[model samples]
Target: MQNLLSIVIIGIGATAVMDLWGALRKPLLGVPPPNYAMLGRWIAHMTHGQFCHKSIAASPSIAAEQIIGWVAHYLTGIAFAALLIGISGPAWIQNPTMGPAFAVGTGTIAAPFLLMQPGMGAGFAGSKMPNPNAARLQSLLTHMAFGLGLYLSGLAVSLIC
Candidate 1:
């Protein structure tokens, strides 16, 4: 029960931290925040046995895509948080450290680089992006930010516990 609470908070906090980075990227790097609705469209298509697309933007819109994207985004965060604790042990929640969090955050790069990007037609490591290097950097930095978030959230949760 205690671990559950910590997991939820840490997950949401880390995810929000990633979102914060996305928000700031627009001003800092001239890159707009990601459109989760596009992710939603991708997921929606999955329900119809379509997993890959030439361009997610060109994909047809589905009902409640925005809502679906937002929900899935947060849920993914929570799942990642769980993964962190699972790998680092529940004691991580009691005494959070940067090592595990950082490793997990950076390791999560695989998801987008290997799966999400290709599935969304962004190519591996966002190679299909207009500026592939920039896209890759953005993705890397975002994941790193998520790691920072996890560590910070764990510290906060530890204090509360």
Candidate 2:
């Protein structure tokens, strides 16, 4: 039960930290925050067997897509946290380190790079974008921030739990 609580806290906290970076990136680097609505749209279409899209923004919107996207986004973060814990073991919860958290956080980019981006018609790692390198860099930096978030959240959990 305690481990579960710690996982929830770490996941939500780390995800929130990632979100904070997203919000700041627009002003700091001219990169707009990710559109979760589009993520939701993609997910909704998945229910009907639609996966690939030329442009997710061009796809028709669905009911409560914003809500769905937000929920899924956070849930994905939690799942990532579970992955980190599962790999690092309970000892990590008691003595959080940056290495494993960083590995898991940045490694998760595989989901977007290989699956999400390709499915959204951006090619691998947003290679189809007008500025693919920039897009890829942004993704890398964002995941790094998520890694930092995991470390920070783990520290808090360790101290409190």
Candidate 3:
């Protein structure tokens, strides 16, 4: 139970860090923040057996999609935390380090590149976007920031637990 709690804390913290990066990036780099509503739309359609969309934007909007998307976002963060704990084991929770956390966090980008993006009709690695290269770079940078978040969060968790 303690370990689980610690993981949750770390995960939430890490995800929060990533979100902070997104929030700041818009003003600092002029990169618009990701509209998680699309995530909600994608998930909402999944309930009806619609996994892939030619363009998620064109897909019918679901009621309360924003809520669903935000929920999914946090859940995904927790899941990533679990993944980190599972890979590193309880010992890691006891004395969290930066390397493993960062690796796991950054590695999660594959989900977007291979699965989420393609399913949302953005093609592989956002290839269908107006500027695929820029999109890909942004994604990579965001994940790297997530990796840093994981490390920092792990440190915080270690201090508390």
Candidate 4:
């Protein structure tokens, strides 16, 4: 139960960090992030093997791809939190540094490379993008930001409560 809660917190925190980073970087660099909602949709489509294009970006899926993706997303976090709990035990669950946030953040590098980039038709981790190097960098940065967010948010929670 505690592990679940920690994972949820880490996931939310990481998402927030990614959002804030995009917002801050967008104005200065005129770079826009890929649509998060669209990303979510793409993830949802994972179970149905519909990872082609975003033709149905705005539509709903009967195959439960979207729901599955959302659930998987949260579950990933939970899994990370569980890892942290296992590694550090209960005492570190609320540590905020080496606990929930760290575990969640550390685990984020895989999604974009394996799932997200491929779904976006960019190949694994953006290898099929126009510029593979830039795409890979973007994926790394975003994932890193997410991980940092997880860590920071967990820290905040620990400090506050």
Scored by lDDT, the top model is: 1
Tell me the tens digit of each residue's lDDT in model 1 across 40-141: 888989999999999999889999999899999999999999999999999999989999999998888898899989999999989999999988988999
Instruction: Tell me the tens digit of each residue's lDDT in model 2 across 1-161.
Output: 88888898899989999999999999998899998988898899999999999998888999999999999989998889999999999789999999999999999888889999999889999999999999999899888888888889999999987
Minimum summed lDDT over a 10-residue window in model 4 is located at 54-63
The CA lDDT at 111 in model 3 is: 86
Q: Which stretches in model 2 have alpha-carbon errors above 4 Å?
A: none
Looking at model 3, residue 60 earns an lDDT score of: 91
Clashes in model 1: which pairs?
Answer: none
Which sections of candidate 3 miss by over 4 Å? none
Among residues 3 or more apart in sequence or in different chains, the pairs in candidate 2 whose N, CA or C atoms overlap within 3 Å are none
Could you tell me the lDDT of residue 137 within candidate 1?
Answer: 89
* CA lDDT scores, all candidates in order: 0.93, 0.91, 0.89, 0.63
**Tens digits of per-residue lDDT for model 4 on 1-161?**
65567657756666667667777767866768655555566766655677666343544644555455556555665565556556666665466564444445656668778866666666776777678987676666766677677667667767765
TM-score for each of the candidates: 0.97, 0.97, 0.97, 0.69
> How many clashes (backbone N, Cα, C below 3 Å) per candidate?
0, 0, 0, 3
Off by over 4 Å in 4: 44-49, 52-88, 98-106
